[model samples]
Target: MPRRARKYAVRTTYATNAALALVLAGALTACTGSSGSDGGEDGKAGDSSASPTAAEPGKYRTLPKPCDVVSVGTLREMLPGAAAEDDGTAAPSAGASPYEGEPTATYDTDRRVGCRWKNATSLSTRHLNIDFERVVSYDPAVSDDEQAERLYAKKARKAGIPLDPDDTSPDADSEPDPGSEPDSGSKSSGSPKTDSSKKDGEKGSGHKGGTSPDGHTSPSGAPDASSSPEDDVTDSPSATPGEDLAPRSLDDLGDAAYIDDELHTADSGLHRDITLVFRTANVIATVEYEQWVTDKHRIPDSQELQERARELAAQLAEQFED
Candidate 1:
C-alpha cells in the first residue's frame, strides 16, 4: 500500500473503536438508572401497602383491623359542703332522692354504651360523672315568666336593646274581645252579682287574661301574671351544663370542649395506644393503633404516627360547649 493510504487506514480503525466504546458505556449507564428508579418506586409502594386504595381527605386514614378494646371510667366526687351550697343546694349524695347509686360510673369493654370509633383508623371511648353536690341553687321571689323577661331584657340591653312598642291589639286571628266593663252600675241594682266572682276566676284560673290556650291573648289584659318572670330568668333544661358521655375519635371532636389536653405515642411497636387527658375540664379520650407489617426490616415511622395522634386529640377537644 501507498504510505499515505496506510496512515489513513490506521487512524479510521482507532476512531471506530472509540465510538463503539462510548455507545457501550451509555447503554450500561441507562440500565443502572432504570434499575434504581424501579427499586425506589417499589419501596414506596411497599411502605404504603397498608393504606386504602382511595380515602376521603379527612376520613379515617388507617384503622386497626378486627378492632381492639379500650376501657373508660369516670367519677364525680362530692364537693365539700361549702362548695355544694354555693352551687345552689347541699350536694346530694349518690343514691339520694334525685341521684341513685355511687357518684362514679364505669364502662368496661363488654358494657360499652356511648363509646364509638371509625372502623379501621381509630378506637374511641369515654365516660362521665356529674357532682350533684356542686350544683348551685337558684332562687327568685317572682314567677318564672317575670324572671325570664328580666333576663331577656338584661341580655338585650347588653346586645343593643330595642324599644318594646305598646300595641294592645290582639294579633291577627285572635278571639272576639271580651267586654271590658264589669257593669258596675248593675251591681247596686241587685242583679245578684259582685266583683269577687270575676276577680277570683281571673286570679285562680291557670289561663292568663289576654292569652288563650292556643297562645292567643287579648293585648289589653295585664301581661299574664301566670307567666312567672322567674321562670324566664332560671336556666332552661337545655341550658344546663354537664359532661357529655359520647366517646369520639380525635378527628370528630372540636377544640372548645377541652382544657389542658395532650397526646403521646410509643417509640417502637407494631401496636400503639394514644392517651389524651383533659385535666382542668375533666375530659379524657384514648386512641389505639395497630400496624400491618409488610416487611420485617421496616419499622413503624415514629414521627408520622405521633403527628396523627395529636391531630386526633385536638379534634376531640374542640367539641366542648363551655
Candidate 2:
C-alpha cells in the first residue's frame, strides 16, 4: 500500500514542476519581444522628430552711423558752397573738421540711417543726402540677401527705370539703339522735343547766353547776362540722340544699381536732382544730389550731377565691403 502511494505522489510533483517551467519561459519571451519593439521605435525617432530648417542670417549685423560715414572732403564736393577750413586745396584733418553732416532722424539705427547736407551762398544752393538700409528676413526659407533683392526690385519698379535697357515691351519707354529716331516734331535731328525739353533746351548753357529759366519765350530773345560760353553743355549725357534724360539701370555699380536724372522748376529757381541707388548683399545705398540755381537761365547739368552721385554710391558700397 505504501509503495503505490509513493509512486503517485512523485508523478504529481513532476507535473507541477513542468507547468511552472513552461510559465516562466513564456514570461521571458514576452519581455524580450517588448524590449526589441521599444528599441525599434526609438531608432526611428531621428527621422520623425527632427528639427526644421531655418533661414540664414544676414551678412551685415549692424549699420554704420550715417552722418559720420563720409569725409569732410567728400562733403565739400557733394555740397558745394559748404564752408571749408582752407581754399579746397587739401582735405581737413579728421576730428578737427568743422563739417559735421546733419543726421536724419530714424526710429531704428540698426535697420536704417541717413544723412543730409546743404550749402547756400550768393552763387547757388546745393544739397546732398545718403541713406543705407539693412534688410533682415524673418521667413525660414528666405535669406537676408534675398530680402534685399526683393526690396531693390520694388525700388527699381517705382524708379520707373527699365531694367532691361534694350527692352522693346510696349510698356517700356526706352527705345533701342538702331530703331531709335528723333521725333518728327523736334526742332532738329537732336533729342525729340517735349514741351519740357524744349523749354529746358532754351534755358540750357547751349546758347552763349542762356534763355530765361521761367519757361517763357524771352521778349527780347536776348542772351542771359549771367551765361558764359562754358555753360553751353549742361553736364547732360544723351540717353539717345533723340531722347530726353530718362532714369536708367546701371550694371557696373553693385549687385544691382540705377540712376535717375530729373530737372524741375521750384519756387526759388530751376532745380536739378540726381538719384543713384545700389544694392550689395543685405545692404542698399542711395545717393541724392540736388542743385538749385538762382540764375533762372542756368540749368544744372544732368550728367555732371549723375557722375557725382554715382561716385558717392561706390564709396558707400566699399564701406560695407570693408
Candidate 3:
C-alpha cells in the first residue's frame, strides 16, 4: 500500500473515533442534567408536604339511639297526666302507650335520631321530644365539633335566642347576627305570639300588658288585663331580673346551651312549649317539653318547666362524654 493512502485511512479513523466520543459525552451530560432536575423536584415536594396537613378528627363519630338516651323516669314526670288513670285503675288502660316513646323517622340512625312523646289527660296534654345529631365534616379543612358548634349557633338564632357574646369556639369565628332584630315581622308557621324567654331577661315574666302581669300582648302600649291568660301570675314581663324566664342562652348545661319558652292560646286551650338545646363535643342534643291546659286562666310555669328541662339536658350531656 502507498504511505499517503495508509496515512489518510488512519486520519479518517481517528476523526470518526473523536466524533463518537463527543456524542457519548453529550448523552451523558443530558442524563446527569435530567437526574439532577428530578431530585430537586422531589426535594421540593417533601419540603411543602407538612404545610397542607389534614385536620384532626372529631371526638364522636357515632351517635346513640335518641329514644334510649331518655329514660322512663323523665317521661313519667314530664307526662304526669299519663299516671292519672293509673292511680284509679287496677290494670293498664287500652289507651295510647304513654311511656313507650315514639321514635322519629330518619334514614340514618348513626347520624341523626329523635324520640317524641305525647300524653293527653283530661287536664293537660304533655309533650316531650329528644333529638341527637352526630355531625360530620366532609371537607378535610373542618372538624366535627366545629361543624356541630356552627349548627348549634344556627339553632339558637332560629329559636330567637342570642348567641353567647363571649363564645370563643370555632363556630364563633364571626360575630353572629343580632337575635334581637325583630323577628321577620311575622310569626313562624304554626308559631303563635310568644313571649321570648329573653323578653324578661331583666324582669321575671315582666308585665306584657302595660306593666300589668297578664298574658295579653298590648300592641298599643295600653294595658289590656282582660287577656285570655288574664289575672294569671305567669303573665308578661315587667318584674325583676330574677324572673327573667324568657328564651336565653345557658352557660352551665353543656359545652353550650339555651332554653326557649313560648305561650299561645289554642281552641283546646293555652299551651306552653319549653325547649332546650345543648352541645357536647361533636353531638347536639335537644330537650323540648310542652304543657297544654284547657284552662286559659293559667299558663305553664316557665321556672318549673325550665328547671326540669335543664335537668334533663344536663343528664343527656353526661351521656355524650362516654
Q: Best TM-score goes to which candidate?
A: 3
Candidate 1 segments exceeding 4 Å error: 50-322
Q: Rank the candidates by TM-score, best first.
A: 3, 2, 1
lDDT of each: 0.26, 0.59, 0.62
> For model 2, what is the alpha-carbon lDDT of residue 46?
65
lDDT of 1 by residue, 1-322 (tens): 9999999999999999999999999999999999999999999998788554442121212212111112111111111111111222334453121112222222221111122221111111111112100001122233222222333233222222232454232221122112111112101111111111222121111111222111222111212222211111111212211222112222234311111111211221112122222211212133322121112233333333334444544433343332
Q: How many collisions between residues are there in candidate 1?
A: 37
Off by over 4 Å in 3: 1-33, 36-51, 86-96, 166-243
RMSD of each: 30.2, 12.3, 8.7
**What TM-score quantifies how close candidate 1 is to the native fold?**
0.21
lDDT of 3 at 193: 28
- Candidate 3's residue-wise lDDT over 1-322, tens digit each? 8999999999999999999999999999999999999999989998888467666776887777776777767766666645543432343355445676667765567776778776555445566778776677655666667767876777777676878677544543253323122222112211222443334332223223121112333221221122222112244432222436777888887788888776554444555667788888877777877665555565667677777888888888888765
lDDT of 1: 0.26
Per-model TM-score on C-alpha atoms: 0.21, 0.61, 0.69
